[model samples]
Target: MSYTPLVDAEGFAAFPAPAKLNLFLHIVGRRADGYHLLESIFQLVDAHDTVWLRVRDDGQIVHHNPMPNVPAETDLTVRAAKLLQTATGVSYGVDIRVDKRLPMGGGMGGGSSDAATVLLALNRLWHVNWQRQALMDLGLQLGADVPFFIFGRNALVEGIGEIMTPIETEATDFVVLHPPVHVPTPAIFGDPELTRNTPSLKVSLLEGTADWRVLRNDLESVAVRKYPQIAQHIQWLSQYAPARMTGSGSCVFAAFVAKDVEKNTSQNQANAVIFGLPKEMSGFVTSSLQEHQLLGFASD
Candidate 1:
């Protein structure tokens, strides 16, 4: 869905804040701050949000949206703009618009990614001149997954998703499936049975795997237990590729190497399965972006 509103000032600047998959999340421990310490590989996907900004002469951040049901103040796009204005003390404001494609509460880091894109996009549009690290630091205050979008690469993340280490792996394509449901992140996180003490593994070890063995979502079992539909989808998808839950729950994905091969296989099997979804929910493959796109704005 598109949320287009003109920022009442200079022309706009735009950026892509892509969705991410926790290839594997290990909950190693908990911190004194009531936060769980984690180790995971966060892979950025082609899925993203496009955020547009226009500088304001009056030093006041004004966030607007053309979308019918979306509230302006509650939108992450607005919060992100305010965050940049507050942190840098730049004597300027921005008029903001967000073209959202990522699904909300899908464990795809949509909101966090949008926040990161705004922080990085505004640093340039407003001439804040903060380095990448500075932008990332500013992002952490907004959300845990925010920093990953700033770096814009597949990373080994720890410490509530802040600490990052860039890693290289053979690129692959994904077939993402979104069921018609929203899974609240807090519900999964606060579950008493959620494993909070998974041991961490080294990057060197994961690189040596024959298949995605050690790479698993720590919350998958809990999510499936809570939502039986997730378990059913996983069973359906596993017939094609090694499938798993991306983040907390709701959206599950399977990876395939060749499009035709995956297609032919999926076509042959058909019991209680839905295929050829409308453009919005259609399953397809995507590669990770080397970095988030920072460029011009558009509305539709």
Candidate 2:
């Protein structure tokens, strides 16, 4: 149910790079190497960046429209393409065009998802046919979060970000608010005041026993203290639901579930937040996706 292996009408292979929310991020400990051990629920959402790729035989990686202020070489999508080519020794290349709708540095996992998309798409486009685990291993070289996106499901992630256990989730909605400033992950992780010893959680986020309202993001304290804009956005959203920061975030969101989706109440709730937001803040209402669009692309 995850992948449809066909090029679209535009004659380009279109792939979706979806966004994710850390329902709650807990820092359990730190590894000997300095990477923080984490326990988090990663929920995939409908909000996404779209990657359109056309394979080339000449062994060149290209981004048709790179993001502003980001060098084409440094773009994760481009890097992903080149890395896959080099690692697999493939003769094929790609012309990638990105339609970016997610916020950069908002802790929504935009860049990581884009990189996953390229790896997944090209595995299909170039006929490299790597297994999902192999692709996930390659993805880790790009970023810690990259493997989760490649895993392509709602997941419970732990360890230094590579350990993943896919969990079930129903279709859900959220009002995601992106504040104007960037909250650097290093700044949040490096803060001395950040809690590094939150006890581990064992409940299943999929089983309805884990009350998200009681769960908390340990990084939130550090990020909110450093960025007032993020704090303000969280405060505004708190009026409607239990607002929480996602990842080391400048964006905050509140989840909404439906008794009957036919009623369309969740979407309205998301819209209410959007309509009431001040012009300085940006946001959208989005629903969760059960699987990544390229979920079956890899040989699982």
Best by lDDT: 2
lDDT of 1 by residue, 108-226 (tens): 99889888877776776788777778777777887888878877667778888878887764455666677666788778888899899876675554465423434688888888988
Provide the overall lDDT of each model, using Cα atoms, as 2-decimal numbers.
0.71, 0.88
Question: Which 10-residue window of candidate 1 scores lowest in summed lDDT?
Answer: 291-300
List ranges where model 2 is wrong by over 4 Å: 2-10, 203-208
Least accurate stretch of 10 residues (summed lDDT) in model 2?
Answer: 2-11
TM-score, every prediction: 0.82, 0.95
- The residue pairs in collision within model 1 are none
How large an RMSD does model 1 have?
A: 5.9
Q: Where does candidate 1 stray beyond 4 Å? A: 1-10, 66-70, 206-214, 258-282, 294-300
Candidate 2 lDDT over 82-128, as tens digits, reads 99999999999899899899999989999999999999988888899
Angstrom error of the Cα, residue 5, model 1: value is 17
Per-residue lDDT for 259 in model 2?
Answer: 55
Largest TM-score belongs to which candidate?
2
Residue 15 in candidate 1, Cα distance off native in Å: 2.1
